[model samples]
Target: MLDLTKLAREMQGISQHLSQEAVASRQRLELAQQHLKKAYECQQEVMERQEKWRDRILFANATPLEPLNTRIDIPVPPKVHTVIATDGSQIAPNHHEIAYCYLLNIGRVVLHYGQNRYPLMDSLPEVFYRPEDLYMSRQWGIKTEEWMSYRRTASEATVLAELVREVGTGDGGLGTGRRKTGDLGSREENNNQSLIPHPQSPIPALAMVDGSLIYWFLEQLPVDARDRILPPILEAWSQMRAAQIPLMGYLSASRNVEGVNFLRLLACPHPAPDCVSYCPNQLEKVPCKVFEPLRDTALWTTQLTPGQRGPLWRSNNRILELYADQTIYFCHVHVGTEIARIEVPAWVAENTAMFDQALGLMLAQVQKGCGYPVAIAEAHNQAVVRGGDRTRFFCVVRETND
Candidate 1:
């Protein structure tokens, strides 16, 4: 454990530094707020010149698709809409272990709020030990921990896509009439009740995941591994899009400064942005220093009302250039508890109706869970592999091997 007694002096020093920074932070925020006001006054010009900045900044920042200050009210969610979500957890492989194995546990959830559908909740735990799984991992020259996370991402997407296809094909098993118990605790069959989709009238649903859709980590691997791993995930996404499902990734209490960074670009005093010359780190000492202490969510909270959502912006990243149709777009919305960041693919962002409804449904979900999305929270509950479970898993493997 940690010796708090020994850390007292260090803690005091840290506190003193924070107190000094607090004064500096306020000055940065004030200058940023001023620049934001100027941008709002000339919003049209700002939008027009957005394309030019991409060439100058040469870094990832959110480019507003519409007016910077525009806010859309959350449309009231439909009385009968379904929210389907999937989340994942993993047991990373340790080299010291006899079995150098990793496990991925995916939680699948279907919460039907309409007339005839019952919710379905289940977890899928997949353990990899096959030569192909290990062989491809070793080829990347990365740690098993890093490699396992990539696998988990692919697995989670595949699982969500599979469920979306199931719902699309009318095999979701959500049926009419309530089952004797609430939701299925495990994968047991509810033979007593009639299934959810009648195959005639399918329910409208929204698909969600608990984290980012961007597979940035996959870029670190070799071309062979990237080709091997990313295609299946892209294909899974393709399936969801082909089925016309509205999929999203929900990030709560996000401190992402992509929006603020865009402000930095706007606030840059350069006729031509020569970052290496004038400003490098965007520090208080630099030319583009106004937004240094600000965050996207914090800035948005000051602007967005309880029911309003900020504009969707196409996020810039080199990895996204290859995504083609899967390029990411994100928005900040006041979800009562905090200003939450919501990310979606290019198609959803392009479709006006889908975008509004997506926000509304997410807001409804947040209200249900008080501060977070209920489907994601429940999915996390199902997916999490606690310390006890991890210990027992090794014990079981040891016994089986003996």
Candidate 2:
């Protein structure tokens, strides 16, 4: 029950504020584009450019994009593939309820595409009501929403990794075919393969995470929670890696500026040694300032065609500092009018065959959902806890306690 009259008036005021900001943002975007044009025209010492003004300039310090691959329009080859996607939703603890409790729900969908379309889905909800679960520590305070978010992410990673491990081991009742290298060739081929310790084999399946592989929420966790949560996630990741499961994190509507940052590197006016410790006065002359408000997608919108993917760029997040082994590289994919960012680990990113398959499957999934990954969309649909269900859940808890 909101006060409709007051709400309408407040919305009107908020809309006006947004309108003004939108106007300013457009002006800034235009200026940024102008600077980008000039910088591209004078693309000298591009690799040597430094991120000196990263702090002073908003959206600065972006690594200039180096296109490892050109715009590719590989059609989605007709293949029977297995795609598993997982998504999670959480309900923060409500103090008004009978017990201090929170709920985490995870939804997963496994789809087999080809002659017979079979979809297997599952939803799991874990309710936390114990005193130990309600609070982080007696001395610290109650478990904050951030703690709950970390739990949710860890749960997501666990589910994804476990699914990958199961699929990798040729279990989980999935309809994927595990093709051994020896099946295709003769004794000489067998001799060639048997000589190597670990031969390159195509993974039978792909595991799709609903978000980025890098856990940003880890940056905010308390020491205790941080220590407790990361192990399971990393172990699961290790299992997936050992099994050679190809995993991709898909962001349907990404607002990433990695491309923009890359453009900034290209725009650095001063050459190397001087640019690294560039002063404010010299920074003012840098060209990338023109594209401040524009995200990587904005630049790639016109640059890529439908189903075409842009180059891979390394992420610069501090969280990535520890994950160099699983270094993150993202590519911009043209999904109709929308641009999607697909992030993959170093194993998948560096492997040409795996990269192409991931990209193609992603494109096929996007087409299925019109603009987004259909597997993720379906998983979300299954995972979402409706408002009515939440109200009823709390009501049932209260009645049971009574």
Candidate 3:
């Protein structure tokens, strides 16, 4: 329990500490703004040399296809378009439960606009009790939160892939589209119009997930666990790419600093940043530490209008080497309320029509939902498994078995 009386007494001291830090916070912001201005000035050289910095400087720098200061207005979305989204939730195996089992629930949503197409929203739940499902290796410990999260993401991607096939190409899903009722409702197929290279009125749609598309966390997992998680997500991305369906992962009010780290690469004082040799020995303040306090949102919100997006910045993480051809990219967009980070793959960023449509539809969805993507908002409503629900789920397992 919290001590409210003690907390009240400590409030003054907390305020004093915050007051002391205010000046320092402003100083860091000013320095970051100045460095961002310099970065924009030398933006061409930065992107030109950004590749070499990946090995030379050991920070998460980004490679951009446009100047950091460049902002594009969100395209006016087509009145007739569709947004398909998928999200997942899970209950890890608990020792306190009657049965040691985990549950994964995938929420699927499809909202078609302008035309008279009925929206579809559904949740699919699966339970796993097998040893193979709970353990990645014979030597591994209990399934951790990080482990289950990746599994949930894979499940979401797999569902999104199915939705894309049914919606984008009119081809039947890869047989993984199982709902509570085991049906993926019939989709209206338009074989005459292909999505690649911007089909004329051919499925103006975006497939979305709740978080980042990059599986960079694979770097932290053991080789065995990595193999289990990465391939499924990659396979899902591949399915979407082959269909040319523009996909995005909407991160609201993202505090990501990838752009700032790239700015650090440009601001490196040393002629060539030999990270291993220089970083370990540096006792003084790192030259680029000035920009560390700011996120991409802080820099772009001031420069962009509502429904405008910043330049596409390719992730420079070496873990992306495992990503093969599906290079991950991100950009900042102000969706009328706050600056958000939207992540996509290389193919989507390269195609102007697909890129604009995705962003435009994203902005439209956010506006329709009032500051959040509607499909994601609804999908979350479907995917979330509350504590009460978990209790009942385990209760059912206990009752049915006993």
The numbered model that scores best in TM-score is: 3
Tell me which residue pairs clash in candidate 3: none
lDDT of 3: 0.76
TM-score of 1: 0.87
How well does each candidate superpose onto the true structure, as a TM-score?
0.87, 0.76, 0.88
lDDT of 1 by residue, 1-402 (tens): 988898997999999999998988777777777778787777666555556545556445777777787888899988777788889898877676668777889888888786576677877777777666666667668666777787777777777776787677776634222212111112233333325434476566789998777767766778877775677777778888898888899988776788877776677678755565555564337666556657888778788999889988888876787678889999988998899899999988888888888788889999999989999999888999999989887777678788
lDDT of each: 0.76, 0.66, 0.76
Q: Can you write out model 3's per-residue Cα lDDT over 214-257, one digit (the tens) per residue?
A: 76677777877777777777887888888888899999877778
Q: Which parts of model 1 have CA positions greater than 4 angstroms off? A: 1-17, 47-50, 95-98, 173-196, 276-285
**Total clashing pairs in model 1:** 3
